[model samples]
Structures are given as C-alpha cells and as structure tokens.
Target: MQLVRWGILSTAKIGTQKVIPAMQQSDLCEVLAIASRNQATADEAATKLGVPRAYGSYEALLADPDIDAVYNPLPNHLHVPWSIRALDAGKHVLCEKPIGLSAAEGEKLLATASRHPELKVMEAFMYRHHPQWQAAKRLVEDEEIGALRAIQVAFSYYNVDPKNVRNVAEIGGGGLMDIGCYCISLARFLFDTEPKKVCGLVENDPNFGTDRLASAILDFGTGQASFVCSTQMVPYQRVNVFGTEGRIEIEIPFNAPPDLPCRIWHEKEGATNEVVLDVCDQYTVQCDLFSSAILNDTPVPTPLSDAVANMRVIEAIRASASSGKWV
Candidate 1:
C-alpha cells in the first residue's frame, strides 16, 4: 500500500515516451516491469525506462505477484479483453481512453470491475487531472462564466498513415473514437449532465475504412455542445465555453504540453482576465491519484461508470451519423 508496483502492458510509444515516464516520476508508483509481444522489444523498453523486469508476453507480467497494478496502453481493440484479463489476475488497471469500443463493451468492463471491488479500475483520461482543467471547472462551478449555455471544441491532427493502428477500421479507429471522445467527455464534465440527443456528420477514408473527419452536436436539454475532430486536418485543439453573461476559453484544451504554462481566458461584462497554471505532467498526477485511491480505498477521478456514460454519447453519435437522423 505504500507504493504501487506497476507493470506496463505494452511498449507503446505513448507509454514509453509519456505515461510510463510520468508514472515513474511519481513517488507513489514504481514501474517494476514492462511487457511486449516481442521479447527484445520488451527488454529494450525495460532498459530504456530503467525498469527491472521484462516479459515477452503480457500474461507473464500479469502473473508476477510483485505487480499490484497494470497500465494498459494496448490498441483500442485490445483494451477491454486485456483489462479483463488483468482484473482476473488480481491487478488494478489504468486503461487508456475510450476504454471500450461502445457502451455495451464499457458495461462489460464495469461488470468485471464490480466483481473485483477491492481493485481500482480507471480510464486513463490524463487531461482531466491537469490543473488547468481543474481550475476551469472550479471557475465554471463558481459561476464566473454565469449560467452555462454552450461549448465548442475542436481537436484535429493530420495522420494519414494507413499502417498506423488509428487508421485501421478493424481496430476501432476513427476521429470520433480517437479525439472526439475528449470533446464528449469534456462537455459532459463541464455540464455535469448527459446529452438528451445527438446529431452527427461523418466522413470516412475510402482506403483506410476509418472515419477521418467528423462533426457532432450534443443536446444537453439545458445546453448544447458541438465539436469537430479529424485525423487528417491541420494540427489544432481548443475549447470555449459560453455562458449567460460570460465565456471562458482554454488556450490548450487537450493534449496540453507538460512543460508549458496552461492558460484559461475569461471574459465577463466588459472585463477579461487570464488564469495561468504552472506547467504540470497530468499523467503523473493521474497515476499518483490512482495509487492513492487504491492505497486509501477511495474513488478514482474517472470511474468505469463515467467511461460508460461517455461511450453512450459516442454510440449515439455514430448512430446519428449512419441514419442521417438525430439519435
């Protein structure tokens, strides 16, 4: 309970470059091992990360009694199955975002977590742990932005490589599933309500068989959220919230740089103010938070139920896009 012994599920770049290092930097987490399908890959990752152990197969890492938890950075399609396997092996899990392909799959993950109530299972939406987002939420709740009205989110990046897992349809690749989920989760977090209806427009890559661009509107009854996400557009990301008498804008909404100051701009009545937060590594905060939750038997910031709610909206968006009708 003093320190959470961690085992990484893969040698994914996200893990090797970002999440793992962030976790390693936390005093509450000790990344003891890393695994990859290829032994040499795992060994190399372990050496590079200063991890003491390496395993050729994920099962070997899961079987290690020393590892109390796992960081599942596997492909989107492998998330649920491997997370379930980890839970079955008595290890807590911090799975990557979009925890499941759909709401039904998310429900299954929840059911699995329910059976192992002692272990903590969380979706790795690292941005939620960032101080800037926390500050923005506090300001919104304090009504500095007045009554909430609407939210606009834009997240895109140009990546057309057909060989990348994100561009493959069979592995659950799409702009909505990849980056759009952030838009949905953020809207839900700010409004503190689920969307009553949703409408979407989608365009797929003919050769890749995955959605490259998408626009969606989420109706929250009292408020609305609109977003555009693409895998083949200029690199850009931002979020703006409009209220009855004021508005707030997040200069670096998603995928914020860990070393740069985060800014939140607020405008009200004829006055404008900017709040600056010190640079922070959100992934480390996320890991430490989860570790504390496990050691203290408390709740994680983003639970499996939250993942289900987000996935529900995502499913609705897909439905609306396909049927050419609001869903």
Candidate 2:
C-alpha cells in the first residue's frame, strides 16, 4: 500500500479536533472520507476538516471501496460493534480507547479481529506512542529508576454537562471508562506486567448513574500501581514511577501538548536529572506507525489483544469496587 486511504466512522469532536488533523499530518495516510448520522453534518465536517468525501451513515463510508482503513471514534458502547462492522467490510481499524464496556464484550471483538488476520486492528492509546513515554520506558528499563517499586498516575477533568454522552451511564459513561483507562494502561506499560490482584473505590453520580470519582490499586507482584481518576474534580494529569534507588516524574504524561517540549524529571541519591523531548504530536506518530505497520506487514503498537488485557484489569477493578474487597 503506497498510502492508506482512511475513513472516519463518526464526526466526533476528538476526530475533528485531534486525531484527523494528526492523521492528515502523516505522509503514510490520507483521510479521504468521513461519516455522520446526518448528511448535512457529515458534509459540514468534511468541508471543515478538508476531507474529500462525506457519507451520511457509517455503513456507507465502510462500503466505499476507496477507503482501505477506518478510524472508529464512536462512543464507548458502539466501539466493538462498529469496529467489527468495519472489519467485516475489509477495512483495518483504529478504535478509540476502552474498546468495550467490559471484558466479555472486548473478548468478542478480539475474536472478530483475530478472524480477520489480514486487517490490522489497534486501540487508540495515543499516549503510548509519544517520545516522553518512550523515554520514560527506556529510563525504567535501564534502571534509571533503579528497581521499580510502585507507580502513581492520575487523570481528571471536570465535565458537568449532564446531556453529554460521557455523563450518561446507559451508554458506558464514567471516569473509569473515560480517562481512568489511561492510568491503568500506563501502569501496565511501565511495569511490563499484569496485576495479580486489585482493589478500588468509586463514588457514583446518582442522577447520571455513573462513576464520577474512582481509584484503584493494582498489585503487579513485583510492584504496585495506584491511581485516582475523576470527572468531577479539578483538571490535572501526572504520572510518577518510584523505584528503590530513584524516581521519575512526568508533568505532561497523558494529554501532552503538540506545540511545546515535554520533560521528565528524575531524582536519585541526592541528585536530579531532566530529559527534554521536542515538541511532538503523538496522534500523528500513532497514525504513521499504524500505517507503516500495515504497509510493511509489521506489528501495530497497541493491538486488540492488548486492549483485552487492559479490559480484564478494568473489570477486576470494578469488581473490587462492588465487592468492597480485593479482586
């Protein structure tokens, strides 16, 4: 494939404002078409985003032979279903995070992706592709943080729109499902292991019937990862990896800025060091990596199986919260 022709499944804000523009910046791919529930809406997005084609329905976009791949930014509940539909249509997929509402649902989607081995399916965890994260991983693996002991991550933002899809529980709305997944994913990435046990605490929004504030502790045998995520708290994001000999702190860990340098602070034995990374767009890196993988028959950065593993940990956390005990 000289260049992958891409189609977007929804006119989601994240697509219009972030990923699409980032993908457009990648030389390996071109976003040719976009779809929305309404024709006018799709057309508006196409014109605004400079896409060449617009379809009123997702199925129409999937049917277009010109589209070789799809970016599924549909709501959480629609992720697996729409991704499966695109896969059946012979289009590779890059679905947004938390690919399913639960582990069982994620498993079914994973099985579907498995059957279509010719196509690539990846979860859109844009952060993992950023240089800052890559540097952090190298430092940890190099023992710059000494022997990793624990990890701390937090991602939160205040969203009070009751009518927004994120505030509706019936559609898989919650902090844990929304931003909390970042904490869980990063923990697993840095530790390079899965948790043996977990515990959690969550406070729900009675009116919305969704978790507003949540926290979890994942015991990874060799280390422990703890995080707090909230949709009703002050906006903040940070990650810290603690080791027996030192620690590394990431200021712009998750939602890194594309226009400014990102840095990691390391402290050890009464000394400190800072690693500076150039201004970079993680979404662009993510799209380019996936496109290159597809073109060269290499491996994607974040595969569907990895999403299933993260979902399993997420399910365990929810279970622990419900039972008020370790799970």
Candidate 3:
C-alpha cells in the first residue's frame, strides 16, 4: 500500500501522546505535517514528531496538496467544522470521538463528507481496535457467553483540576461527553446494533455547572445495556456481558488510553473459563485501520453514520435526565 501522508490539526495532548506516535510507528502512514493554532507549538510538534511540515492554521494544513489524510484532534467544538474542511480539501479524516455536540451535528458533517466521494470521515474510537476488544467480540460470537442478552460498561476518571477543559460545558465538558461516550459507543459495538431507546440520570457539579456524573440504560432490540461514567470520581473502567446460558467480563480500562489489556470470563458447563490478553497499543491499531481504509478504500470501521447513532443515544440520555421523563 502507498503511504498515506497524515497532517495533524492540533498539538492536543492526545495528538502528542497517542496519535502522532502511532502514525509514526505505522508503516502504512507518515507524519507529513503538524499544525496548531499556535505557530510555535506546531513547529515544536513537527520537530518532536519528525513531521516534515508545520502550519500555524488549520486551513494551511488543509491546503497542503500532498497531505492525503488528516487527524482532527481539535477541541470538541471544532471537530465538525475541521473535519468538514478536511473532506472539502479532498482529505480523508480520522476525527476524535464526540465529533459533534449532538446527533444532528454529526449528521450534517456526514452529509458534508458524503458530498466528497473521494474522501472518508471516521470517528476516532481507538479502543475498538484493541486486541482485547477483538477477543471479547470473538468470545461473544463464539457463544462463550451463550446468546448475549445484556451488558454493562463503565469508564470514569477524577479530573479534579478546576481548570481542565472537561469541567467546562462551553467546550463540551461533562461526564456524558467525556467518558460516558465510551460506554455508549461500546454498547453499540458490543450489541452490534443501535439502541432503540435510552433512559438516564445526571448529577451536575455545583462548582463546574456541568454534569460531573451520569448513567444511562440503553434498550437494544433483544437486550439491554447499562452505562455509568464520570469525571469526578476514582479512576475505573470495565465491561460485563451476560447471556442466556453464561456471561463474559472484560475487566480493565475499556476506553480512553488505547491498547489496554483486559481479562474475560466465560461460564460453560457449570464452570468458569477465563483468559487474559496481552496489552497492545490501541492507537497503533487505530492508525493502522485508518490508513488501510484510506489506501484500500475499505469501509471505515466506525463511520460517521454509525457514530451519529451513539450521539443520538447521548442526546436522548441528556433529554431524559433534564426532563425527568424518558426521551
């Protein structure tokens, strides 16, 4: 496959710590450009990541004729616009999760991307690519857990820093947007179907004016998924799935940092079967998949079409919590 030259749209912490490193490590991709709202930061990142080009503005990177793909690690508010910009510039995009404020926003972005047949836009949910998750999916399909019927996923971390962007609603800060999204996204992937309805409860922080903790129940066609997430709690992440005859549990960080290792348990013939997977870099897998989609024109794993479904569930959760009634 021909190398896809990648341009990162920001010097965000995730970009510096996960994505840039993964792209550099991927043989199918190259870190061709780095851009930031700040010129000095862009230059610094380009030098640090060994990217060949640096730009002070997002548009400058988009205008680069050589850039085949773009990574939009910009803040949540800019996700849709920047992704649209990249698509219009004829570049495939791998955008960070919560790519829109609502499902409608994601739909609009998808529409914009659809106009560019030569381009593809995908949400960056790197955990889905981890070997641990792959094993979990195989176990589910193998009926190690019998016919899957229910699931529970949780991801929370205490970000007590008052100045952190997650505590601010204006910048898309909240439990539902920050960590809860993992639960929602995972539910869709685990169930392999969109939730028909959702019920939720939210507890907002008095100091931050954002929902610091939230929980939701997703009603799939044949099963149910319960999700709990927070940004003002002790760090925790795990997933459990139950079926008619048995169950499976993946005990580890299920999202956020990629390449997390997890253990699975299966109940068969009145006995418990368990296995642990080796830790793998989920970010590298994510980059690998994105590059494959670009080079081979294969369908994106988590396309904007499906990502919008997760956003809709989140919107429903927010509505249910705010209205004190099912949405």
In candidate 2, stretches whose alpha carbon ends up further than 4 angstroms from where it belongs are: none
| Model 3 per-residue lDDT tens digits across residues 1-327 | 589899999999989887888778888989899998879999998888788999999899999999999999877888998899899898999999888888888998999987987787899988888877787788778887788899988788888677877887888888898778888887788788888888999999999888988998889878999988888888888888888888777777454344445567767668887777776677888998889987888888777888898888889999999898877
Give the C-alpha lDDT of model 2: 0.93
Candidate-wise lDDT, in order: 0.93, 0.93, 0.85
User: Where does the lowest 10-residue lDDT sum fall in candidate 1?
Assistant: 252-261
Off by over 4 Å in 3: 253-261
- Better candidate by TM-score, 2 or 3: 2
The C-alpha TM-scores of every prediction are 0.99, 0.99, 0.95
Candidate 2 lDDT over residue span 26-52, tens digit each? 899999999999999999999998999
By the lDDT metric, which is better: model 2 or model 3?
Answer: 2
Clashes of 1: 0
Error of 3 at 256 (Å): 8.0
Model 1, span 127-240: residue lDDT tens: 888998998898789998889999999999999888898999998898888899999999999999899999999999999989999999999998999999999999999999
